[model samples]
Target: MIIPILYTFYLSFFDWNLIAPTKEFVGLKNYIEVFTDPVNQKVILNTLIYIIFLVILNFVIPYFISLIVKFFISKMQGTYKVLFFIPSLFSLVVGAMIFTWILNPVSGPLAYILKAIGLTMPNWSNSGILAITVICLITNWKVFGYNFILLLTGLGSIPKNIIDAARIDGIPKWRLVWNVILPMNRGIAIYVLILTIVQGLQYVFTPINVITTGGPYYGSSNVIYQTYLNAFVLYKTGTSSALAITTFLIFLILLFLEIKFVESRDKDYV
Candidate 1:
């Protein structure tokens, strides 16, 4: 793990094709190019957009849905769990392909249904926002369910005594959940939050590969996907390495913040 990452970092300062016997050192030029390249800039922006969408669809939505299912739903919670989780059982490839067929602006069922109402489906593939949204939708189908289950487990893990005491004191359901449940659930909540950001930004890789190939001009690509494009498709090893290292540092910072936040919260959590 460490070796490849270190090698990639070392390789970032040089220009090398994977096949080349000679590495030409061009210290920090690749990193400079990555920052200045219009495509890389867009890809980075797209990744940030992906994070925002994923946080909403996969993180915030699932957290609340888990809360609702766990607390409010009084019956057949098992069935709901199974229904939500079934999508996660399939691979992203399957989900992407399924959505591809379902959402195809031409000749897709959605298009056909819209046509029946004298309406036309917008060409999502031609637009950046819609393309990314489609990718997010495909990813959300799989991720939302998994996050829901994980969060549901966290909510379940809350000490029953705390909940019981809150209830005995005639705490309103909303107040009990807001004042008591949310704080204790933070441990798992933050884990899911970070996982959501990680998966939220990265999980669209398969859908993007299949649906857009990061097109209408890299409209749907994230950092991970862009790195793969540079390394394998473009065969620019140095640039890819720079991208890899840049992404690593960014995520490393996120991991550090998560640890610090959790540690401080644990101390303050009672």
Candidate 2:
């Protein structure tokens, strides 16, 4: 890991190509180009968008859903868990392909249902925002259950004595959840948040690749996909290395902040 990362960092300072034998030392030129390139700027923006939506849909929504499923539907919780988690068993390519069929505006079942209801289906694959939204939805559908199960495990780890004590103190149900359960699960919550922040962009890459290929004028192109395009598609090894290093630095800072601010607070709660 260290060797490859160091090598990539070294390569980022030079003009290199995978196919070409010759290499040129550019000394920050690749990094400069990455920052100034218009498409890369858009790719960064799309990455931020992907991270925001992925965290919200995959982590936050699943956390709340798990809470509800664990508390309200305690009897059928096993069935619900199985149903929600089934999608996570599929590979990313398969999941993306499934959603691509579902979102097909012309011949998909979604279009058929809309037509039956006398409504027009929008072209999901060609529209930028809609395409990203579809990617988020599909990605969430595939992974939300996994997160849900993690949160459920977190909930289970909370001691029954703590909950019983809270109830005996006459805490209302909602207040009990807000004050006791949520606090007790802070460790797992922070874990989920940090994991999402770190891996969110990578998770969205597959659907974008399979469904839209960052289409609608590169609207959904994220940092990871852009790096892939740069290295493999465009054969700009140095530029790709620079982009990867930049992304790694950004996420490293984020992870530090999470550990410093969020995890520190979790310690207090725990």
Candidate 3:
């Protein structure tokens, strides 16, 4: 893995073509070209946008949703837990397909409501930016239930006695959660943050492939999509390899930041 990764990084320094049967060692030229190219610039910006939405949807929204689920589940029992987890069982393909049908302008229930209300429902899959945002939304909806399960486990790890003591001390609900519950579950918080970032990046490929295919003027095409287009569509091996290396580096940097954040939070836990 390291060899291939390193080789790609090395290849990024060259202007090589697979068809020409010639390899040109153009150090930093490819990297410079990638930065200067308008299409490449758009791809990079779109990728960063995707990452921002992915982190917020996959981490922040799910975290809050899980908290809500756990809070409600405290008074409920087994059946509710199973019901809440139903979405977790759904595959991404299935979820995306379901949402696509539901978003259909002519026949979907949502569209019908919008039409009744004298409003327009845009064709999300056809619009590049809209498609990308919808992809993130679907990803959030699909994975939220599983995130809830993870958070439920974290919530369960907290000792009930401490919470009861806080309640008895006349602490407000938010204060109890912030001061008592969150501090105790710092490990869980960090674990969730790291896992969410990793998972969000990993799954970004699915929506781009399934829904947009980097269409509607490359609006939804992220770095992964651009790499795929270069390697598979255009058969530009060197360029794709360069893109892969840059993407890996960017991913590593993001991962490192998350690791540092986790480490900083861990100090409180200790």
Candidate 4:
């Protein structure tokens, strides 16, 4: 892992096609190009959009659902767990293909159902927002189950005595969850949150590659997709390396802020 990263950083300063015999020294030009290009900028924006949507689907929604299952639902809890987790067992490529067929605007089962109900299926591939949403959905379908189970475990691990005490004290359920359970589960929450942001990007790559290929004028492309395009398809090795390095730096910064945020929250709880 470290070797590839170190090599990528070294390669970022040299101009080379993937097949080139020798790389030409380019200094910082590749990095400058990655930052200055309009397409790359749009890809960055798309990446941020992906993260926001992914966090909502893979983190926020699962967090709430886990709470509901852990505290509210009494019947069929095991059944619900199995149902929620079934999707996680599918590979991303298979999941992407499955959704592609299910969501095909023309002849997909969804389109047929919508048409039977006197509605037309919107061609999601035609719109940037929809395209990104479709990709996120594929990723979410595969990721949400695992996240839900993890959060459920975290919630379940909260000491029953504390919960019983809260109830005996006539504390509202919401207050108990907000003021006590959430803080107590911070470590698990932090891990899940970080995993969502990082793995979300990686997970979407398959769907984007299989379905959209960053279509609608590269509207659905992300940092990882752009790097793959540059290195493999476009054969701009240096630019791809530079983009990878810059993306690593961006993620490093985000991770740092995340830790600081988690630490601050911990201090507040103390």
Q: Which candidate has the top score in TM-score?
A: 1
Tell me the deviation in Å of residue 41 in model 1: 0.8
Candidate 3: regions farther than 4 A off: 77-81, 257-270
Give a tens-digit lDDT track for model 2, residues 1-270.
Answer: 999999999999988778778899999899998879999888888877888888899898999888888776677888878999999888888888888888788999999999999998999777777888888888888888888888999998889998888889998989999988998788788778777767667888888888788887899888898899888888899999999999999889878877876678767766
Candidate 2 residue pairs in backbone clash = none
Q: lDDT values of the candidates?
A: 0.88, 0.86, 0.75, 0.91
lDDT per residue, candidate 4, 83-128, as tens digits? 9999999999999889989999899999999999999999999899
What does candidate 3's lDDT look like per residue over 47-147, in tens digits?
77877887787767766766665654566635555775687678778877788788887889899999999998998878767888888887777666666
Q: What is the C-alpha RMSD of each candidate to the true structure, in Å?
A: 1.9, 2.3, 2.8, 2.6
Q: Clashing residue pairs in candidate 4, if any?
A: none
Candidate 1, residues 209-258: lDDT per residue as tens digits? 88899899888788999999999999899999999999899889879878
| TM-score of model number 2 | 0.91
